[model samples]
Target: MHRDTASQRLHGDLIGQPGSRDRLNTPALILDADAFARNVARMADFARRHGLILRPHAKSHKSADIARAQLASGAVGLCCAKLGEAEALAAEGIDGLHLTSPVVTPPGIARLAALARRIAALSIVADHPDVVDALAVAAQGGPPLTVFVDIDPGIHRTGVASPQEAVALARRIADHPSLRYGGVQFYCGAQQHIQDFAERRAAIVERTDYLSTCLAALTAADLAPAIVTGGGTGSHVIDAELGVLTELQVGSYIFMDREYSDCDLGDGGAKPFETALLVDAGVISANAPGLVTIDAGLKAFATDTGPPAILAGAGESARYRFMGDEHGAVIGPDLPGIGARITLGTPHCDPTVNLYDAYHVIRGDVLTAIWPVTARGRSA
Candidate 1:
């Protein structure tokens, strides 16, 4: 048997500690074990109290080891963005797979159908009848394939445009011999990190109304969407209040990014979660005045959301700005000298993590252990 005991051994020692290597490398992904667990526990406890199922988005970390940690902390399942990611997770032997994106081709559908047999639960989203038909044909009964009707909740993205369209698609799924109607998947990706709480709330409110209308329409047509899954880390609370979502598929709660940390979380002005993920880089050049350079840049971190931030009290008075691949410039007061180490909060957690092979878990400065980013580059 392939032993998973290795993960437990490695994860056991990689928490927060100081006094190890101050400047060993550059452009490395770092995980603060204590902060990560705290983030997990916080979300788990919230889900428990709210009576909402927590199916964390695995796309954020894309690590089977982290996915296992999330499941252990009370996640009902995992949400991956593509089939490759699902297959990777399967290789690690973690069950409960839900592909957030639709699988619509010959090879992809067939592969997903085969995967359903191995996982405890497998779900896919459909925006049209053609997609549903494709899945039904491939999944000719190894295990029942659950299909969620993707509804456009005002974002005009991957979901079906109208409630009537969603209902019609739902009927098709129910009639399909190989598919089980898994309800609705409504996620407004554009609103996930809107900085302004009111704007975010308004967007969700509008989207929720449309989602509820679609659910009601489905019910009127004698179609019951058993699961109404949606929401990200930014809108979990809003999803909870909507009373329509049976589960919250929020990711990034486990590792709050710089972009999310800046968003206003409705009540007063607090972030939905704490920042837990960071990139550790070293100063490669401190030869200029009021200017310094580090090893992390466009290739090391994601710039889609924004620039990364220096971790608090890391002897970093300088601010990090992306220069190009493999390099970043720093501008601030009393920046660390050459060979000094720095920790950075990624602008976007999901994509930033995709760039790394493994996370170097450390407690202050001690190199505790490492976990592979098993699902990285699984963008299919």
Candidate 2:
């Protein structure tokens, strides 16, 4: 399982201890087991009721345990962003992995071919013809690998630029004997974090309309994609209502982060997701009058989203600042004293999660389990 030493030691010694939560070493990743369960169930039920296949992205949690939980709750499979993440999970016996990003390099393609042999339903994306041609050669090296033509919805990041280009690629994929043209992948990553619900929905509709054109073109050419995938947590509802994606690539709803929490979820004020994932940082120094230093800093949390949010103790005006790689200061009135444990909300769940080696799973005050982040550094 590639479990970290601290997590392994703690799991054996501190599990079932009355104050296990308090005894956790500083700057530890925490997951409220009950809340996490509820989050998983809610997303699964939503997908079931809506008639959408749920293939939640494993890139967010990166834990085989979490991925299994999602599968138990009716998720069809797990979607990964990197080949390394898929290989790591496959080693743990996880199946139905679909790589969202393209593997264009010679070595990456060879690895992709190898992974396809290891995993029965391994699928990948192709944004360019050279990538497709290379994948065709690799597919012959292993079993027939499922390839999804990545359709770019004006992001200019990846995928075929136009509907004509998409259709051409789909045709090219069909010509290859060891390749299966599964479908198209249109992920609007840029629109997922739009603060306002209406604005986010508008952005999704625009992209969804663009995807429809690609789908229509492919269908007209008798190359209709059997599985249309790609819709993130932020745009899940909007994308579902649009009736395009057959399956969802929703991630981050399991561990509601500050970025997704700030977005208007159409409930007026309440978020659709609960804050299940958290960082438990201990107060190190309280000598500063209005601010107290915490054990978690840049190294503990992701710096891309500014700073972590104090879930309690610090008032509404509380502002977290990065002091150093190993330390952070929470500036606000009536801060917690030294040794007091502070729960923090991550700004960006995916990257913030990558910083930790294990998750200290808590069911109330007891340490239930210590799930290792098996794919922590498997960013290949």
Best by lDDT: 2
TM-score of each: 0.92, 0.97
Q: Write the per-residue lDDT of candidate 1 for residues 1-380, one digit (tens) a residue.
A: 12343333444344334554353345678788778888899889988988888888889998888989999999988998999999999889888888888888888987898899887888989897988888888888577789999888776768899989998999999998888998888888888888777788888898788788898899999997778888988887777776778888888888888777888765565554667788878888988888779888899998886788888424456687889998998888777888777778888888998887777766666767677888888898
- The alpha-carbon root-mean-square deviation between model 1 and the true structure, to one decimal in Å, is 3.1
For model 2, what is the alpha-carbon lDDT of residue 343? Answer: 84
> Candidate 1, after superposition: displacement of residue 248 in Å?
0.6
Assess each prediction's global lDDT (C-alpha) against the native: 0.81, 0.89
Model 1 ranges off by over 4 Å: 1-18, 21-24, 269-272, 312-317
Clash tally, candidates in order: 4, 0
Error of 1 at 92 (Å): 0.4
lDDT of 1: 0.81
RMSD of each: 3.1, 1.4
